[model samples]
Target: MVAISSPGIGSGLDINGLIGALMAAERLPLGVMNARKDELNTDLSAYGRLKGAISDFKSAMGSLGAIDKFSVNAASSSNDGVFTVGASSTAAPGSYSIDFSDNGTNQLAQAHRLTSLDFADTSSSIAATGTLRIDLGGNSFDVVIDASNDSLDGIKNAINSATDNTGVTATVITVDSGSRLLLSSDKTGAANSVTLSDVSGNVAATLGMTTVSAAQDAIFLLDGHQVTSASNTVTGAIEGVTIELNALGATGTTETLTVSRDIGAVQENVQAFVNAFNDLQGMIGYLSKGDLQGDNTLISIQSEMRNIFNTAPTGLGTSLQFLSEVGIKTTRTGELELDTSVLNEKLAEDFNGVAELFAHDDQGYAFRLEALADRQLAIDGIIDTREDGINARIDRIDAQIENFEYRLTLTEARYRAQFTALDGLLSSMQSTSNFLAQQLGSLPGSAAG
Candidate 1:
């Protein structure tokens, strides 16, 4: 049955007044219902955004969940000038034996010597120079002095800046009132030689004589086997082992032993995955909670959010009910936590079994749970029903307003026509009265005459 509106007005309806009253009532419910629906829509949209964020978080965690690793051993240098991987020096300053029997030795290394040298003057009224010249592998560079034209301290500045260069660096050490410059080379070879030509005016030279020592290639033993390596650190000579020289000491006692990315990198990868998983749980908790001190809508959602991991996938055994199997768990306050140690233990114990756990039967627990969380846990979930109801209410309100408008329009038209006819009748009656008054006045004047 069609519903009838009960706006009071049977006989003489005021068109404008009736229309105005009906419109006011209709507008109120229409506006209110639509506003409520809009608010719900906004909420649903926010939920969608959060849901997407949650999905991204989960995917990120999944990506990190797997182990990742790369070896960090020093690179293998095919020859000199090529950077390679290996250990450094550990021995004290002393002599050692090296056999370059395979690669042989260069005569230039044996005969190399300094031709000319210059040291900056500190008190000659000119800025101290930090420049030094060195011939590395027959390649020469005008090594800038550590000191600059700006001050008398340029010599000290140059030494510190020579890192990752062709030559070594040294400074003067003081004993009592006497000081001498200690020089070190970047490489260990007969070719690695240094000579001083103009140290008389240099800062530390004024205190002592500058000496150029005979240079030789680094001599060391790999596994006690004599190996004459051109450079101090030998890389790829053995897998995952690198050697660095002891600058202040000899070779054996203090060689720098560097262990490459051996096997720990894989472990680090797994831990990274666990950390990412924890991060995702944190985001889920934040999105689901409302307040810092207490709970709200977001909190309720968080509390219920655990359903994503609480159930096992279909056809999979009940053993994989939660992330605890893989080391993720939820707390009473609705936070997700992970223990990487436990996870790593599980991975180490049964990697394939765990893989099957995530993909057991057809789709694994993680996959199914992720799908459910991404699709069903929020407002637009399979069982969740509120947005549609609100929208329907709004639509119903709109229809009622439309019906009210139609009724009011018809009533207004009928009333306007009826009132127009009544106005014509009143006008005719006033005209007739004026004519009768004129007739009566003329008859009375005739009697007086």
Candidate 2:
């Protein structure tokens, strides 16, 4: 039989309460270990916030490191209705007076359109078995006009659905009398003109197609020098500049296209970086007040970022080599500040010189800071190493807690066993005393009581 004994049943001792009191002392170390685990977890959460801040700062570094951030250019046209201008990194700062000449024709480039005579209806047979070769730009396709599909709509669909129909579109338009088929080049410019020829059929001749508009190239005078483009979207006339002719222009009139270094763009980009840095500073400040107070890794990260901006880049071969030269400064509160006026002045005076300060391949502040962040966030890097160490410590504490709980379990069992045995002995001693008292009372004063 399994010995099912209740310790307090016979002796009336509070054995459960006594065992609970003893086990409370045994579990003292557990309370301390659990509190330490909570602290470590809080530290982990703080590091998470710091890691996110660093990542955002790294993205800012990438943005500021880009060479294009400094090379931005804004191009403007005197009359945007007549033309618009776009400038790329290769475009130098300059101005060009634009005039539409086109051999003094004052005409924009036009796409070719061929319209066929009206037919009786869409589904009626318009042609016998015949074929026509259609060509546009570098693409050509053959359309068969036969009894299976001979109506105006059929012919339109056949030309449109041709396998190799390149840059040509066919559509049917309703005329006063009937429906008419129209063929157009899908592209603009003289080089992309459409051509239709009779091939094994008289479809081209039978349609009596008339030219609605002829293909033409755009010719504009750039500072009295003739610049020609097959398309109205003119490129390569000026290095890295594209001129989009919006409308036909007269010979006597002209518009000025000015390409200038966009100092405002650089200012905006730098200001954005400054704002991000300040936000990171604020985040670090907030996180420091909590579990990360006086954290050495966070301190090192902030110090490196400050050092990158404070020191002048070497080997740039330019007088403008420091961020302060362009008006970025550190304030008393440790936040970055930008003075757009000074930055604009510097950029206007020497754009590329200003560019060297921030975007140089090797010695630039952005470059160094980006590399630093890469090191800090890389595999087994600074933050990673710290996180790994914390995890290892937490794991050790967890094992300690697990083993401590096992010991407490055994300790509680032993306490109960010892108290149960004491209660049993006390109950047996009371039983013996009661037996002796009952015998004595029965012999002497059993009746008096």
**Highest-scoring model, lDDT:** 2
Question: Candidate 2 overall Cα lDDT vs. reference?
Answer: 0.83
- Best TM-score among the predictions, by candidate number: 2
Q: Candidate 2 residues 120-190, lDDT tens each?
A: 87778876558888888767889888888878888889988887879788888887888788988878888
State every prediction's TM-score relative to the real structure.
0.36, 0.77
lDDT of model 1, residue 167:
66
The residue-by-residue lDDT of candidate 1 on 161-191, one tens digit each, is 6564556554544455433345555665666
Candidate 1 residue 366 C-alpha distance from true site, Å: 3.7
How many steric clashes does model 2 contain?
0
What's the TM for model 1?
A: 0.36
TM-score of 2: 0.77
Clashes of each: 47, 0
Query: Candidate 1 vs. truth: CA RMSD?
Result: 14.9
**CA lDDT for candidate 1:** 0.47
